[model samples]
Target: MAKIVVALGGNALGKSPEEQLELVKSTSKSLVALIQKGHEVVISHGNGPQVGSINLGLNFAADHEQGPSFPFAECGAMSQAYIGYHLQQSLQNELHDLGIDKPVVTLVTQTLVDKEDEAFANPTKPIGLFYDKETADKVSEEKNYTFVEDSGRGYRRVVPSPQPIEIIEQTSIETLINAGNLVISGGGGGIPVYKDNNGDLHGVDAVIDKDKSSALLAANLKSEQLIILTAVDYIYINFGKDNQEVLTEVAVDEMKKYIDEDQFAKGSMLPKVEASLQFIENNPEGKVIITSLEKLDDALEGKVGTVIKK
Candidate 1:
């Protein structure tokens, strides 16, 4: 059985807590199926909506002076715990129903990033709830937060999207996986961190792309496949256009060419493809499968989605 790292998109998780739990129940079934197929599973998930909700709640509390101010990193950790909690409970129950006994654990992971990354100078990753122009402007002015209109869906707080240099809990994660456990780690890009002048690790107010972080994690673990579950069934070129084409199978170099041509959208399919390439670069024999959660089984069986290989 192959060891697989599955990177789940935040969009796949519903917006509200109730919705998230229900969606995760379904997600757990899919993961259990993989386990039944004899594959070892390690899950890493995006936390855009969850962390945004936390940040919004913390911002509201801070605005009202209801409690101590919570930093972005703290909010990330909170998101990770809540999300992992849901996954752990759901997956465990699903495993029990399927009569497959296995231990599932979540690690509040930390990912090291470069302090000199250019993204730090220009924060572009958007988070938190969307707000109208007036509210957005007020928050930006009062809190010195950078706001950007996201796809005309109102304004959102933007932060740096840094590259992950290392997974701090890589050894622990490996140990868990080696022990035949279903591991979930690196939620919200593992709490973005950087080394300070004293060579001490410090949590930074930044967001790392989940796909990129997952790729790094999978490569470090020497996984044979990196499965990225998103909202789309397959990677498409000329997306949204009438002439849109679906790519069922793509070579790593060919995918890079499409990226150079800007075939994918930033903050979406682009990063997924980039992460796939990153993992393949680190592990030449590795492959990446990009598909929707519903199509995961089909994708694994070569029935659907995009597959990138060296």
Candidate 2:
């Protein structure tokens, strides 16, 4: 059986609480199918919508004096725990229904990042709810927050997206997987942290790309395959253009060529491909599968999606 680390995109977990729970139920079912097929699965998921919601809630509450405000790291932790809760419950239920006796667990994971990472100097990762130009301008002026128009979807708060240097809970996660339990960790890029001058760890107001962190996790765990479930069935070059083409299979060198040519969007498929390359570089024998959650089974069967190898 191949050990796989599945990285779920933010879209796989819906935009709201109700939708997220329902979607995760379906996601769990799909995951259990993989288990039935003899794949040892470990899950990692994005929290773009969830953490954004939390940050917006906190901002609103603070603005209205309804509650005290918390830091970004705390908000990230909240997203991780709640999302993990939903996954644990749904996966356990699905496993039980399939007559598979296994424990589903989640760790409140933390990822170490460089204190002086260049990303901090230029915040680019968008988070929080979208706001109209007027509201966005007002918030920016009053709160000193950075808001950027995201793909013409309205302005959103952007934060530093640092690279994940290490997974603090790597040992525990490996132990759980080794013990035959399905594990979920590294939610919202594992709560970005950095080391202080005294060599103490401190939480930072930053986001880490989920796929990037998942690649690091998969490499650290020595997993043979890193399956990244996104909203698309395959990675495409010239994504929205008429000549756009889907790549069914790609090599690391070819992917790097496309990346150098700026074929992928920065905050979208680009990071996913970069993560895939990272994993493939670390484990030359490993494979990275990129596909939509709905087409997971077909992708696994080599009928759909894109596969990247060394």
Candidate 3:
């Protein structure tokens, strides 16, 4: 059986809780199909929209005297718990219906980041709700929050997007995976944390790219395959242009050259591509699968998606 780490993209989730649960029902079916075929799967997902909405709601409540203030890290934990709950429930039901004996578990994981990572000095990741300029300035002044005007949509809170150096609970995660458990973990690049002088971990206000975290986890777990589900069915060069070309199977050397070309967009396919590179670099024997969630069958059959390998 192949040990696979499936990193779900934003398309796997919905904007609201009710809708997200419904979407995961279908996602579970696809995942269970892999399990039935004798492949061990580990699931991880993006929480960009979910975490932002959660942080916004909680802070609003706290401001209204309805609850205690929640830091971004706490909100990250909350997002992981609830998302894992939904994924766990759906996977259990799906496996049960299929008469599979595998159990699903979600770990509220933490990722360690460098305290002096240059990203800390430059907080570029935008999170939480968008506010009017006046409101943003007021909040910035009162709460010491950084606000950036987001393409005229409105001003939004920005946080550091640091690199994930290590997965703190990797040993536990590997243990669970070894026991044939369907593990969901490293949610939203994990709650970013830093170690102090005494080696104690402290939570911080930052966002680590989920794609990078997924790659890190897969490499650490030593999985044979890392499947990244994005919105596109395949990686394309000159995307959205007349001369665009779809990449089917790319060797590590060729992929490195393609990565150097300005074909992939930074905010979208670039991170996914970069993460795939990291996985391949770290685990030379392993390969990566990148495609849309909608193309699961074809991707699994090697009829679609971009396969990166050494």
Question: Per-residue lDDT tens digits of candidate 3, residues 42-138?
Answer: 9998776678888878878989999988877888898899889999999999999988888889999999999899998988666666689999999
The C-alpha stretches of model 3 lying farther than 4 A from their native spots are 124-158
Q: Where is model 1 more than 4 Å wrong at Cα?
A: 130-143, 149-155
Candidate models: Cα lDDT each: 0.89, 0.89, 0.85
Residue 47, candidate 2: Cα error in Å is 0.7
Best candidate per TM-score, number?
2
TM-score of each: 0.93, 0.94, 0.88
Candidate 1 total steric clashes: 0
lDDT of 1 by residue, 202-268 (tens): 9888888899999999998899999999888999999878999999889988998999999987756
Worst 10 residues of 2 by lDDT: 148-157
